[model samples]
Target: MLEVQSSLDKFKKTTGYWDFMEIGIAAIMIPFFAYQAYRLPSILSKFGAILIAIWLTCVIYTALKLKKAKPHEGDSYIDYLRQCMEYLERHKILSRKLMLWYVFPCLIGVAMIVVGQLDLLDKSWEQIIDTRMVWITLLIFMAIVVFAHQTNKLVVKKEFTPRLKKVGELIRSMEEDQVES
Candidate 1:
C-alpha cells in the first residue's frame, strides 16, 4: 500500500512536468511560427504558418485540458489513476496524429523546394539533371524524411512509452486491490 502511494505520487509529479513542458513549448512555438508567417508574406509561408497554427492549437488545447483535469471530487486515488490512464491514452493517440499533421507536410514541402530550386542557377532542366547535383539533392531529401521519422520514434520510445507503461501498471495494481476488496 505504501509503495503504491509512493509510485502514484511519483507518476503524478512526472505527469505534471510533462504537461508543463508541452504547454511551455507550444507557448514559444505558436508565436514564433505566427511571426514567421506574418513576416514572409508568401503563399508557402502562409500555408506553413497555417499548419503550425493548427498544430499549436491542438497542442495547447490538449495540454491545457490535461493540466486542468481533476479526478472526481469525492473519488479515491484509484479513480485518479483511472482518470490519468484515460487521459494518457487520448494524448498518445493525439500525439501520433499531431506528428503526422506537422511532420509529413513539412517534409513534403522540403521535397518540393528541392524540385523548385532546379532552375535557380539559370540552367536547363536536362543540363541540371546531367550533373551530380540532382543525386545529392535526392540524397538530402531522403535523409530529411528518414531522420524525422527516427526522431519521432525515439521520442515515443524514450518519453511516451515508458510513462504510459507506468500508468498502466499503476492502474492495474489499483484495480487488483479494488477487486480483492
Candidate 2:
C-alpha cells in the first residue's frame, strides 16, 4: 500500500511538471508567431497573405482552447496531466495543418528562388517581391500553419484524448471503490 501511494504521488508530480511545461510552451508560441507576422509584413504576395492570416487564426484558436480548458475533476494529478496532453495534442494537429499549408507556397518559393538564380527573375529582394515571390513565401507560411493545426488536432483526437479519458475513468472507479470500502 505504501508503495502504491508513493508511486501515485510520484506520477502526480511528474504529471504536474509536464502540464506546466506544455502550457508554457503553448503560451510562448503565440508571441513568437506574432513576431514572425510583424517581421514578415513585406510578404504581401498571395501566398504570404494567406499564410499570415491562417497562422493568426490558429494562434487565436489555440489561445481560446487553452483559455476554456478547466481543471479535470478530482484534481487527480494524472488527470490534470492528461488534460494538458490533450491541449498539446490539439496544438500539434494545428501545427501539422500549418505545415501542409506551407507546402505549395514553399514549392513556389523554391521555384522562384531557382528562377532568380538562373537570372530568370530579378535576384534582388525588392525585385523578388515585385516578381511575386512574396506571395509564394506567404503561401508557404500559411501552409505551414495549416499543417500544424491539423496535426495537433489529429493527435489530440486520436491518441491523447482516448488515453486521457481512459485514465480518468480508472481514477473515478478507484474513488468509487474507496467510497464503498
Candidate 3:
C-alpha cells in the first residue's frame, strides 16, 4: 500500500513537471515570435500569408478533435497518468509534422541571413530587408509558432485536464469507500 502511494506521488510529480515545461516553452515562444514579427514585418509575403492561413486551419481542426475526445478508463492513479503521458506522446508526434512545414522557410531564412551578411548578393539594404523572400520566411516561422501553441493547448486539455479529473475522481471514490467501510 505504501509502495502504491509512493508511485502515485511520483506520477503526480512527473505530470506536474511536464505541465510546467510545456507552459514555459509556449510562453517563451510567444514573446520570441512577437519580437520576430515586429522586427521583420516586411518579410511577410502573399505566399507566407497563405501558409499561415493553412496552419491556422490545421490548428483549429486539431483543437476541435481533441476537445471532442472522451477520456479513457483507468484502474488507478498511475494508470491514468500513464494514459495521459501516452496522449502527450502522440501530441509530440503530431508536433513533428507541424515542424516539417517550417523547415523550408527556416532554411531559406538562414540562407538569406548568411548571404546578406557575407555580401554575396548585390541587393541594397532596402531591397534585402523589404524583399518578398524575407517576409515569407518570417511568416512561415510565425505560423509555426502559432501552430505549436495550438498543439500545446490541445495536449494540456487532452492530457493534463483529463488526468487531473481522474485523480480527483479516484480521491473521491477512495474517501467514499473508506466511509462505507
Candidate 4:
C-alpha cells in the first residue's frame, strides 16, 4: 500500500508539472499569436495567427482538463487508482497522436507566415515556390516535428506505459484483496 501510494504521488507530481508547463506555454503563445494576427498586414499572416491561436487555446483547454483528474480526499484507493489510470490513458492517447494535434497545426501556421512574408515582397507564386525560404522553413519544421514525435514516444514508452501498467496491477491486486475480504 505504501508502494502504491508512492507511485500515485509520483504520477500526480509528474502530471501536475507537465500539465502546468503546457498551460504556461500555451498562455504565452496565445497572446503572441493573437498579437501577430492583429498587427500583421498580410491576410495569410492573419490566418496563420488565427490558426496558431486556436491551436494553442485547444492545448490550454486540454491541459486544464487533465489538471482536473486529481483524486478527491475521500476517494478510496481503487477510485484513486482508477483516476490515475484515466489520466495516464488520456496522456498516452495524446502522446500517440502528437503529430495530429501538435505538429500539423504548427506546421500549417508557420508555413502561412513564411509564405505571407514572401507574398508581401510582390513575388509571384512561381517565384515564391522557387525561393529557398519555403524549403528551409519546411526542413526546419520537419526536423522539429521528428524530434518532438520521437521525444513524446520515448516518454510514453518509458514513463507513461510503465506507470499505467503498475497502476493496473495495483488496482487488480486491491480488487482481489477486497474480494477475499
Q: Of the candidates shown, which would achieve the greatest TM-score relative to the real structure?
A: 4
lDDT of 4 at 50: 91
Q: How many backbone clashes does candidate 4 have?
A: 0
Which of the numbered candidates is closest to the native, going by highest lDDT?
4
Model 3, range 8-121, lDDT digits (tens) per residue?
455546645744564455455545544544454344432333344344444445544643342355686555545544554454465456455434544444544444443435
Predict model 2's lDDT versus the native.
0.52
All candidates' TM-scores?
0.59, 0.35, 0.35, 0.89
Query: How far is 55's C-alpha from truth in model 4 (Å)?
Result: 1.3
Models sorted by lDDT, best on top = 4, 1, 3, 2
lDDT of 1 by residue, 37-135 (tens): 677545555556656666777767867776676344245776666776665566566556654765665555444444444543456877877868678
lDDT per residue (tens digit) for residues 10-108 in model 2: 544654575566556646655654555465423433334345445445544555565466345456655554565454455445445544543454445
User: lDDT per model, in order?
Assistant: 0.66, 0.52, 0.52, 0.84
Q: Please give the lDDT score at residue 9 for candidate 3.
A: 59
Task: Name model 1 segments beyond 4 Å from true.
Answer: 1-4, 70-74, 95-98, 105-181
**Alpha carbon RMSD to native, model 3:** 11.1
Q: Give the lowest summed-lDDT range of ten residues in model 2.
A: 41-50
Error of 4 at 123 (Å): 4.8
Model 4: CA > 4 A from native: 120-126
In angstroms, how far off is 1's CA in candidate 4? 3.8
